[model samples]
Target: MPNTTQNAPTNVEEIATSMQDTVLGIWADFVNHSPFLVMGALILLFTWGISALAARLMDASLRHSKMRGSLRELFVRLLSIGIWITGILLAAMVTFPGLTPARALSAMGIVSIAVGFAFKDIFENFFAGILLLWRFPFEKGDFIECEGISGQVEHISVRQTLIRQTSGELVIAPNSFLFLNPTKVLTNLPRRRITIITGIAYGENVTEAVRVIEHAVDECRTVHKDRPLEIFPQAFGASSIDIEVTWWADPTPVDVRRSRGEVVTAIKGALDEAGIEIPFPYRTLTFKHPLETVSLEKSEGEIS
Candidate 1:
């Protein structure tokens, strides 16, 4: 054993030689396996082409089936993404025979955790968006009120929903928040109620004022015949009596505010023409301790 060292290469030289052999062997194998590698690449390309075509066809079929326009787009995008991801995974496996799904998934775990933590809100919104697309609680062009914000749905995306309010303000709401809250879709029904309050001088024929309001409701152009219109005296107050008129109307074909404005205007005009007093606020002032002096001064001003 002591004499063997005298003719043997050093450890460093041996390591270098071993590395060279390994490199040469790897090169030889790669050169010999070129055809197989090329064939695998071709197969992967073919699979990708097929996947793309299949995804397109599926999307077309879904659209043709009369799915909600926004939902259809979302579904098609998700479908295409799934197909491409599948094709990519398959191609990666073909390129590397030892690339196991378990290993790949394990490698992604840490990165996925980081991504999830970094974009928690976005992920929530994305999932909520998917739910919205599938459930279709409302659609584009629908007038919706959510969390006290009322607007027409302008756009729906993977993260947020955009609405344009009647006041010309743009509201951007997170899909997650919208889904978690209560939403009222006004357009789901064909008609809505218009409630108006009018006042008449106190003790001046509450019954007659109510009749006038009823006449106004009946004659209003916006009133729906299918739903009954009503007018009744609500209360007697110090200055006036209040009459409430409630009517149903079709809100689909016209602007709600404008239609309501027209009805109110017509009712007020009708009342004015009929000489039924739509009273405003008035207060009677009286002096207690200084009544005599105030009366004398008021009489003096009137005389002047």
Candidate 2:
């Protein structure tokens, strides 16, 4: 009765007109506050410039400090982040004068929780790396073993550690793994003990062999003299007697190998000169009963 189709068009027109008016009002308000907006933008730009300058100065200061490389980098990065965060907070305040610093910090805390959950592993490794750098467990160039990987520490970054393995492989290991697991710092001590098992004939004198091995280890230039050399009879093998020879040498892998080689050569030469046989595997055969001579003859007659 009231021209329903015409009314629908009118209603749609009314809605569109209302939206347009609202948008125009908002634009008018923005124009009125243009001065404040301009000032806020200038403050943000100034803040960014100041932050950059401060970060550069801090970086230069840290570089000249006597701190370790990893520690220095960590401090520099943290300082830069702190400066930027402060600048951003100041810029935010200038943009929204009604937003209090306390309220903003509370909002940041809430946001940080969400971010933490999202990047759980990243934060874990970051914190672990910080701990490692602080504790000074092992420095660069030190050989270490962790989680079945053995290598020399090439570099320790914030997220990962670079290790150069003995086999010439480069390993990028997560910092969390090294922090959470048991890590053996091979180069922490001045020297490490190396053990070698050598054998001699059953007829050789055990005391004399021990003496010879000890002398050989002592003669090695790479072997450390501070620690006592140990040579003990370990076990009796099928062909020869086994002796465990342990000696302390330089902690480095190269020195360990060189010292072991020299010790072996010296021991072999001394033993051979003394006429002591380094025995090989030997077995003797015996019969329970003597064979009858008629057996072969009877077999041959049967075949014929």
Which candidate leads in lDDT? 2
Whole-model alpha-carbon lDDT for candidate 1: 0.80
Off by over 4 Å in 2: 19-66, 282-304
Q: Write the per-residue lDDT of candidate 2 for residues 1-304, one digit (tens) a residue.
A: 6899889999999999999999999999899877777877787787678767876787788777788766776776677678777867776776677989998898889998999999999989988988888788999999999988998999987788999999999999999999999999999988899999899999999888888778877887877888988889999898899999899988878888898898899889888887888898889778899866668888999999
Give lDDT tens digits, candidate 1, residues 80-108. Answer: 66776666666666667798887766656
Error of 1 at 16 (Å): 14
- Report the CA-based lDDT of candidate 2 relative to the real structure: 0.86
Clash tally for model 1: 0
Q: Estimate each model's TM-score.
A: 0.74, 0.78
**Candidate 1 TM-score, true structure as reference:** 0.74
